[model samples]
Target: MKSGDKVLETAGILVPKVCILGVTITLINKTTEYS
Candidate 1:
């Protein structure tokens, strides 16, 4: 149960990390295009 909980927590953290990473990548691409 503890391991499962940890995995769920890690997945939760990863989901946001992935989202932020995608946003950052898009922002970088836009900045590069504008510049």
Candidate 2:
């Protein structure tokens, strides 16, 4: 159970980080495209 909790926590952190990174990259791409 503890191991499962740890995996869930790790995934929660990683997923958000990946999402934020993806959003940042998308915004940068749009900005450069418009520029």
Best by TM-score: 2
lDDT for each candidate structure: 0.97, 0.98
Q: Mind giving the per-residue lDDT tens digits that candidate 2 earns over 1-35?
A: 69999999999999999999999999999999999
**Model 1 poorest ten-residue lDDT run:** 1-10
RMSD of each candidate? 1.3, 1.1
Would you estimate the TM-scores of all the predictions?
0.74, 0.84
Structure candidate 2, residue pairs in collision: none
Q: TM-score for candidate 2, please give it.
A: 0.84
Q: Which ten residues in a row have the lowest lDDT in candidate 2?
A: 1-10
For model 1, residues 1-35, the per-residue Cα lDDT tens digits are: 69999999999999999999999999999999999
